[model samples]
Target: MGDPGGTDYAVSAEFYDLLQAEPDRRRAERWFAGAAGRARHGIVDFGAGTGIVTRVLLESSGVPVHAVEPAPAMRTVLMSRAAAFGADRRARLTVHPGRAEDAGLEAVADLAVAANVVGCVEPAARRALWRAAARALVPGGVLLFDPPPVGLPDGIEALEGLGPVRMGADSYLADVTRVPDRGVLRMVFDYRVERAGLAVRGAREEFPVWPAEPAVLVAEAAQAGLELVAAPHPDLLAARRPHG
Candidate 1:
C-alpha cells in the first residue's frame, strides 16, 4: 500500500492478486493458522493489501481483525470485499486507512501479522513500524512476518525477469528487477495489462527494501520490547512481547 513516491496502485491493484502464486497464499494461511491459535481477542493485518491475509484471518479465526492499508486504490478494493462479507464477518472486520508505521490504531490485539510488506517499508521507517507493532499488541502478543531474503542468490547479478499471467479476460505481464547493494534491494515492478488483445493499462512501482539480517531484526525488536521467538516455518520470523 505505501507506494512512497512510486507508481500508485491505480492500475497495479487490478493485477495484484495475479502476482501472488499459490505458494504465497498457502504460506500466509499456514502462518495465520499458527498465530490464530495463540491469539485471544483480535488480530491486525498491518499492510492488508486487498484484504488477502485479512480475509484469511477473519474466516480462519472468526475474531476481530484490523486491516491497515494505505493506498487509496487498494483500500477501495479491500473495502469492497469487506462489504460483501456476511454480517457476522463484517462485524468482526475493521479497515483502517493508514500505513503500518502510523495507523493510529487503539485496539491492543493478541496477534499482528505483516505479509510481504516489511521489505517495502523505507529504511528510516522500519524502526517506527516495528515499534508501532510492539505498542499495539498486548503483553505476550506475537508478531509474525517474512522479510525478503537476506542476500541475493548466488551468482545472480541484479536479478531481473518478466512473466505473463492471466485472470479471466485480462492478460498481464509483470517485469521485476532487483539490484542488491549495501543490505538493500532496490526493486521495481512494471506491469502491463491487456484486454481484448489491446494493452489497456500499465504501472511502474519502485521502492528500496532493506533486508535486515535475522539477528539484526531480533536485536532491534528487543529494543522495542519484543523478544525474538523461533518460528515454525523456516521462512518466517516471530517475536513476542514480554509477559507482565
Candidate 2:
C-alpha cells in the first residue's frame, strides 16, 4: 500500500495462496466477519493481494468493496478471481490499480482492512497509510490491520509450515525471517518449488519494514485524526477516524 508498487511481492505472488495456511485465513476471517457485521456502508480493502481477503469479504459481506492493489501481477489474479464470482457479487467488487494511500476516497466506507500489509514499508510510508485510511473512512470507521513487531526476532518463521504443498507432482515451501539493516528490519521471504525432489524454482524477496512498536502506530494514527481502539485480539489493532 504505502510501499507504492508491490514489487516486494512480485515473484512470491505466484505462490502466495498456495503458501497460506487455512488457519491464517480463519484468523483474518474472524476479523472480517466481525467487520462485515459492523459495516453498514461498505468496505475499502487496501493491499488486496491476490484477492485472498477480497473473496472472503465478498462472500461474507454484502456491502460494496473497493479494493486497491498496486502490483500488476497481484492485481491480475485479484481481478481474475473477482471475474469468476456471480454477476451480483462481481458487481459489488471494484478493483483499483493504485496505492491505497492514493485511492482518493472520502468518507465512503464504514470498515477498512489493510491486513498483513504494513510490515512492507518504513514509518514514513506507513504514515501515508494512516492518513489515507483516515481520509477514506467515515467518522468512527474502523481500520483493521496487523501491528508491526517492535524489533526483529532471532529466528525464521516458515509461516506455520506454509508450504511443502503438493501441486501436480510439484512441491512449494516458504519461510520468513527478519534481519535488521540500516535501522530498519528487512523482512525476507524465501521460497522454493521442487519437482521429483529437485529444485525447480526459487526466489528470495526482501522488504524494508519499520521496527517501530504498536505505540508508534497509535501515535502516528493519532496525528492523522485516528484513535486506537481496543481490538478483539492483541495480534491485530483497530484505529477509528474521529468525527470532525
Q: Count the backbone clashes (under 3 Å) in each candidate.
A: 0, 0
Best by lDDT: 2
Q: What is model 1's C-alpha RMSD?
A: 3.2
Quote each prediction's TM-score.
0.84, 0.91
Which is the leading candidate under TM-score?
A: 2
User: After best superposition, candidate 1 residue 215: deviation in angstroms?
Assistant: 2.3
lDDT agreement with native, every candidate: 0.74, 0.79
Tens digits of per-residue lDDT for model 2, 71-144: 88778877777888889998888888878777788888989988777877656778888898998899989998
Q: Please report how far candidate 1 places residue 207 from its true position, in Å.
A: 2.8
Q: Give candidate 2's TM-score.
A: 0.91
| Model 2: pairs clashing at backbone N, Cα or C within 3 Å | none
